[model samples]
Structures are given as structure tokens and as C-alpha cells.
Target: MMLTRRTITRGPFFWLSVSSGIVIMAFILLPLIQLFVAPSVEMLRVSIQDKDVAHSIWLSIYTAALAALISFFFGTPLAYLLARHDFKGKRIVEGIIDLPIAIPHPVVGIAILGVAGKNHVFGQLLAELGIRVMGSVTGIVTVLTFVALPFYLDAAKAGFEAVSPRLEKVSRSLGASMFSTFFRITFPLAWRSMLVGLIMSSARAIGEFGAVVIVAYHPMIAPVLIYERFEAYGLKYSQPVAVWLVLISLILFFLLRILTLRKTVEQ
Candidate 1:
């Protein structure tokens, strides 16, 4: 048997690593960099001032925020359960949670429409109640929440699992109730991961287009607006709004990352 140590750091393995990293950097970073190329001060000023663009931007933020909040409210309990218990169909439940990610957006739109469109059972019932999902804000929020939930749920599950069960037991023994233990100990410790999930869910919700367009095309979100502008006016018009969306998303995403980092440090 023989062993050899390479003296050159830039050998085959090192070059391979460098090439892979460059490929990723090109794919991920280049497109993002492209967003900043156009939209001069005047163009951006005009884009922001445009009523349709403003409406779409506001709608995107509003729906994405609502979706993230909904995820936070519902996903917390699901996270706790998946972390604290084991049972038959656990994997099935997980797969279901992730189904939206794997499923085509158009299919998701069709499924939602089938159940909630004007002629469908729930849609008719809701119509009587003066609530319509088709071509409305409600539909927009519903689809965003449906598609973005897995991001929050998966992240929250991982966070809760990271929490030590022994600590929870100690809290119980010291007279803390289950709810108290979760709020006072587990939640605070898991906040970082939860924050990460919030960002991911928000991002997904804000960027959703295909599903949203099928269900509610009247009220345009950023992605839909981008598509509309591109189709109607051409790339020049669409590029400005696209640039704005990228900038806003990047800002909020980094803010979430910073908040999570701070929470981790405090913990």
C-alpha cells in the first residue's frame, strides 16, 4: 500500500471545487446583478409613481405578509407535533406538507379553482356570504398561504426538534404548564429557525405567479405585474418593476437573516 500527499493546492480537486463554486455564483448572482443594470433614477421614479405598479407592489407586500402571519399561526402547532411525537403516517403528513413545492403551479391553481370557483360548492356557499375567491384578494391570499406553508412548517419543525426535550421536562417539573414551557423556553430558543422560515415563506408568497394568475388576475402582485408589463409593453417596462421587486425582496430577506442571527446570538 502507498499514500501520496499533493503539494499543489490548485490540483484537480481544487480546480473542480473552484469551477463548481464559480458555476453557482454565475447562476445565482448574475441574474440578481442584472436587475440593477437598468431603471435609471428617472425610470424608477416613473415606475414607482405609476398607479398600477404601486398597486401591484402594495398588493404583493400585503398578501405576502398575510401569508407569512397565517403560516406562523398554523405552522407553530404543526411544528411542535412533528417534533414531539412519532406515529403512523408521519412521513405521509410530511410529504403532504411538501406537495405544493413539488406540484406544478398551474395544477395548484386548477385545484383551488375547482373547489372555490363560482360554481363549486364552497364557492357558491361563500358567494351567498358575499365572499368570492375568484379574482379577489381573498383568492390571492389563499393561494399564497397554500403554497408558502411548507416553508414555514418545515423550518419550524427543524427548529422545534433542535430544542432539548430534557429542558421541557425540567420546565414541567418546576410547575410550568405545557403552554408555558413552549412559550417561555422552547419558542424563544427556536425563534431563529422560525424567523428563517418566516422569511422563506414570505419570499415564496411574494414571488408566486402562476397559481395566483389563474385564480385572481385582476389584482396584480409583483410577479403577475411583471408578466403583464412584459407581455403588453415589452422588456423595458417590465424590467423596472422586476428590478424593484428584486431590490425589495433582497432587503427584506437580509433583514430576516440579520434578525435570526441576532436571536441566535442572544440565545
Candidate 2:
């Protein structure tokens, strides 16, 4: 004669929540499923064999990897500093770090162009040194690093924050140097999250289009190539490339999920 909490949770509100969740999930997933399914096996085969597609995919992969590496080397120290210290203007610094993510992609491209275009100071300096930013792999990697750096930085900061300061203090008390303490104790504890962040940043770099297209239109990465094909030819020409990119993204995402799950299990 009495309804318990569990029984109450199964009422109309519960069903509504379930239905809404399903609809949201379907909204996100259906387009991806359609993209993967739309391309025929032969079409996928041909797209894979196409040199331009292959090259673009490779370019995306390697440039993204390079971007992730850059983020790791530079962003890690900043992340550790942010996590361990309280300083004046720290909030402003954090905002600056995150500003790229809030900016529109096309605007980011324009901003980078303004700073790094051949006529710009840094651009001119690089040019004098026989290096180019516009329309080169270096430019692509530069923009990729700009847009993707925040992901790794934020993740690494969170990871470092989660690690206890006491551990480092204990190591210091035991006669370890600051650098040795971090490398031996702190870094290993935080490495998994850093790895996840690197993967996410790499994925973001691989998919980046607007900024990268402005920086390096030639030697296209996969996303720019997809946009180019769609603009020049049509859906039919672009769909195969889209499908290929989607497949690779799915694979990368799947691996990310597996790593995350394993990390969870280990923790």
C-alpha cells in the first residue's frame, strides 16, 4: 500500500527523462552512423587508394602528433605551476589559456594570420631565417598547437591538482631534489591524465579545419580536404573522404575510451 523511493523513481518523470536521453543520444549518433554507412565498400576502397586522401590523412596524423608533443613539453610545466601555486593574475592567465577554445574557428584563423602572416613581424622574422608559416606544414602545426594546447593544459592541470602536495614534500624530506621528486613521484601519478589530454589534443588538431586552412591551404589535412572536395565537387565526392575521416576518428575515440576505462579500473 506504500510506494518506496525506488518505485517513485520509476514514475512518469523517469520515463520522460529516459525518453529525452534517448532522443539526445540519437541526435548525436544518427548523423555519424549515416556518414559511416553512406559510403559503399568500393568507394571507401578507392578513397583509401587515392594518393591525395592518403597524404592528407598522414599529414593530419603526423602534424597532430607533433602538436601534442609540443603541448606536452611546454604546457606541462605551466599546468604544474597553475596547479601548485596561487599567484596574482592567475585567473587572467587561465582565461588567456582558454581564450582560443572560446573563439570562433574562422576568427582564430584570422587572428593567427594577422600575427603570423608573411607581412607580420614574426612571420617576417621567420622568413628572414628561411622558415615560413603561411601555407606550410609548420604553419599547420602552429595553428594546431594554438587551438589544441588548452585541452592538454587543462587536463594536465587537473591531474596535477589531484595529486597530493604532501607526496612531493615527503619526497623532499627523504632527500630527493625538486626535479627528481616530480619526475619520480608526481609525473608517474599524473601521466595517465596527461596521456588522455594528449590524445584529445591530437584528435582536435586532426579535425581542425578553419585555422589550419588559413595557415596552410596546400598539403591539406583531412578535414580541409573534406571541405575542399565538398566545395569543388559535391557531396558525392566528399562523402567518401568524410567516411574515412569519421572511421579514423571513431577508432581514435574508441582507443581513448578504452584507455579511460582502464585508467578508471586501475584507480
The most accurate candidate by TM-score is 2
Q: For residues 162-256, write the lDDT of model 2, one tens digit per residue.
A: 89999999999999999999999999999988998998998888889988887788988999999999999998889999888877877778888
Model 1, runs deviating above 4 Å: 1-8, 260-267
What ranges in model 2 sit over 4 Å off?
A: 1-8
- Please list the C-alpha lDDT of all candidates, in the order they appear: 0.90, 0.90
With a 3 Å backbone cut-off (N, CA, C), the pairs that clash in candidate 1 are none
